[model samples]
Target: MIALIDYGMGNLRSVAKALEAAGAQEVKVTAHAKVIAKAQKLVLPGVGAMNEAIAELKKLKLAEVIKEHIFKKPFLGICLGLQLLFTESEEGGRTLGLGVFEGRVKRFSNKLKVPHMGWNNIRTQNSELRTQKCFALNNIPANAHFYFCHSYYVVPEDKSLIATTTEYGGEFVSSISKDNLFACQFHPEKSQSVGLRLLENFVRL
Candidate 1:
């Protein structure tokens, strides 16, 4: 079973439905602790401001639950979900994150577009999740395209955790992994075929 956490701030229905269409045997969207705790794998999806998301997460007492899941079970975070795994974020006057990864979310300082909303290929930083292999990914080359929509990007202090990277204004962290956890700044659910395969990999794990 795959648990898609309902944090009251994510694109919930879209993500849940996408998981079902992507061959998930059991896909659940909920805020219940027991249901979440029992799942073999969990996914955290978030949208909007970081501070607001953190506040909601804290209110639900799911913060510690999330921490526990990442420590024990396979975990995947998407978009703002990925950012929340960091230590802090500059989204709203420097908000603190879940500190799952040692880093901060930074806003693009470049003169280009603020929110990098479009299709851009991703460059693999390592082979943690097989971004270069055909078994888990198809046609996901060194820089295969994926969908993205965000103003801030995560900056991990440790370079070893970087799984893949992308360029927007300049290169930034596209995806990251640490043991049971795999996170991405891009929305694999909305990225069409390639994205489906990415989600499939997480579900398979």
Candidate 2:
């Protein structure tokens, strides 16, 4: 079963619907710790403030539960969900993140736009999501374009988790992967066929 972590606010239903559309056997949106810990895969989807998301995770006492599960299972984060995985964020006064990835989330200053909302191409960097045993790509194209909706972006201190890159005014970090943890700055639920394929890929993982 795939578990979608739900706090007070999130793109809960849209993500759940998209997961089902992608043919996931089971999908549950919950804040329950045992449900999250027992799930086969976990999807962390958010569309709100950085601090608020972290606060809710902490409130549910599922923050550490998620961190523990990521090491042994497939864990995915989206948009603001990706941001919270970092060590800190400049969203609202240097707020701290979940500290899974060693870095900080910074706002865009490239003069392109505050909130970069549109379709963009993705270019892969250091990626293992391609040839993993259960994650067979078959005829699917890797590094294809997906939907993006965010103002701030992650800047990993290590630079190794960067799986792909997308441009907005300047080249901003798009997607990242570390072990079992995969994340994207875009929303797969809104990216149509490309998005659904990505979700299917994650589910199969």
Candidate 3:
């Protein structure tokens, strides 16, 4: 079963629907740690303030459960979900993340626009190298457009973790992959066909 984590901040219904459409036979949207712990895969999808989201995860003690699952199973994070895996976020004054990756979530520069919304194309890293292909991006074409709505983006200390980069005013890390984990700053659920393909790849993985 796939656990679509519900910590009161994610777009759960839409994400769940997308997963089903992507061929996930079982997708459970639950806040219960027991349910999450038993899931074969975990999908963390979120929006809104990082501080509040992290607080809710801690309050429910899902944070540690999520950490344990990440190391042993397939984990996918969307938008703020991706941000939460970092060491910390500048959003709302240095909110701490799960620290799965060494990075900081930073707001877009004032010169550019806040909340970089709408469709943006992403260039996958090492798309030419078969060995370096990201499983989440399987069958997804290069420069595929994905939906995005966020003020902040992640900057991982380990550049090798970056899977894709998108340009909005300037280039920013759009996705990252390491071991069994794949996370993206964009909303694959809202990205239409290409997005569905990405989710399907995750489901199959």
Candidate 4:
């Protein structure tokens, strides 16, 4: 079963419906930490400010549960879910993040358009994915377009964790992976065929 964590700040229904369409037999969107702990796989999808997201997680006490098991299971984070894994964010005056990875999320420069919306293709960074064999990106064509909607992006201190990158103002971390944890700044759920393929790959994993 996959637990789609609902911290009162995510697009829970769309994520759940996407998982179902991707062949996930069971998916539970819940705020209860116990439900999250017992699930075999976990999906953290979020939208909105990092500060509010963190506050909800803390209020529900799911933050600790997530910090404890994020690396143990097949954990996937989407959009804000990806940003929350970092140490801090500049979205709302340098708000702190979950600190699972050494990085900071920064807003796009005013020189470029704020909130980079619409479709963009990502360049795979992981060596295993170089041959186009990474499980999450399996069968998906190279430089495939994925839907995106965000104003800020993560910058991991350890470049090795970067799975894919996309260029907006410049190149930014588009996706990240380390062991059981995988996350992406793009909305795979909304990326059409390639998007569904990514979700299918995650469910299969």
Candidate 5:
């Protein structure tokens, strides 16, 4: 079973449907720790404020559960889900995060638009290695377009973790892949065919 974590945020049903379309036989949207623990894979998809999301996760005691199982399974994070893995976020005046990755979430510069919405193409960082080893990006063509909607973005301390980069105002980290984990700032559920292909790759992983 693939656990689609629900903390009262995100397009849960849409993501769940998309995962099923990608061939996920069993996808459970749950906040219960036991359900998550038994899941074969975990997907964290969310939107809205980071502080509120973290507060909800902690209130439901799902945060620790996620941390414990994150490295043990094929974990995927989307949008706010991706942002929460970092050490802290500037979203609400230095709100702390899961600390899974050594990084900080930053807001886009004032020169450009606040929410970097709509379609954008992601370029694979290291085509040779990523194409061969990154299962989440498997069969996904480089420079393929994906849907994005967010004002904040992650900046990891370790550049090696960066899987893909996209340009809005300038180049920004679009996705990151390391071991059993893969995350992106874009929403695969809304990206159409290429997005479905990406999810299909993740389901196969």
Candidate 6:
């Protein structure tokens, strides 16, 4: 079973449907810790404020469970879910995050549009993906365009964790991976064929 975490706000149904379409036999959207912990895979997808998401996770006691099982299973984070893995974010203020990775999230410079809402091409960092064997990008075309909609982006302390990058106002961390944890700032559910291939790759992993 694949657990699609529901933290009160997100494109939950879309993600669930996408996962099913990608050939996942079972996909459960839940906040219960036991159900989440026992799932074969975990996917955290969100589209809202970081602080509120964190608060909801804590209220349901799912934060600790996530931190515990994240590295033990195939885990994927999407959008705000990706941002929450960082140490902190500058969304509303200094909102603390899961701290799974040593990094901070910052808003794009005003030079470009604030919320980068559209399709953008993600250029894979060759050496890192080859060395790490990033399964998510496996069988997916190079320079594929994925759907993105966010103002802030992650800045990991280790550049090697960046699996892919996209340029909005200069290049930003579009996707990251470390061990069993894989995350993307873009929304695969809205990305069409290329996105489905990526999700299928993850499911096969």
Which 10-residue window of candidate 3 scores lowest in summed lDDT? 124-133
Q: What does candidate 3's lDDT look like per residue over 36-105, in tens digits?
A: 8899999999999999999999998999999988968899999999999999999888899999889899
State the lDDT of candidate 1 residue by residue for 1-205, as single tens digits.
8989988995788888888887889888988788889998898998899999999989988898888778688888999899999999988898999998899899998797878999998887543323322223434556678899999998898877777888787788888877767888999889998888887777766
Question: Per-residue lDDT tens digits of candidate 4, residues 1-205?
Answer: 9999999995689889899999999999988888889999999999999999999999999999998889888999999999999999998798999999999999999998878999999887544332123568778777899999999999999887888888898888888888767899999999988999999989999
Give candidate 4 misplaced runs (Cα > 4 Å). 125-133
Off by over 4 Å in 3: 126-132
State residue 128's C-alpha deviation in candidate 4, in Å.
17
Which one wins by lDDT: 1 or 3? Answer: 3
Tens digits of lDDT, candidate 2, 38-73: 999998999988988888889889889988887788
TM accuracy, model 1: 0.91
Whole-structure CA lDDT of model 3: 0.91
Estimate candidate 4's RMSD in Å: 2.4
Worst-scoring 10-residue span by lDDT in model 4: 125-134
Cα RMSD to the true fold for all candidates: 3.0, 3.2, 2.3, 2.4, 2.2, 1.9
The residue pairs in collision within model 5 are: none
Per-model TM values vs. the true structure: 0.91, 0.91, 0.95, 0.95, 0.95, 0.95
Between candidates 1 and 2, which one is better according to TM-score?
1
Ranking by lDDT: 5, 3, 4, 6, 1, 2
Evaluate model 2: give its lDDT: 0.81
Clashes of each: 0, 0, 0, 0, 0, 0
Pairs with backbone N, CA or C atoms under 3 Å apart (clashes), candidate 3: none
TM-score (C-alpha, index-matched) for candidate 6:
0.95
Whole-model lDDT values for every prediction: 0.83, 0.81, 0.91, 0.89, 0.91, 0.88
Best of the two (2, 5) by TM-score: 5
| Colliding residue pairs in candidate 6 | none
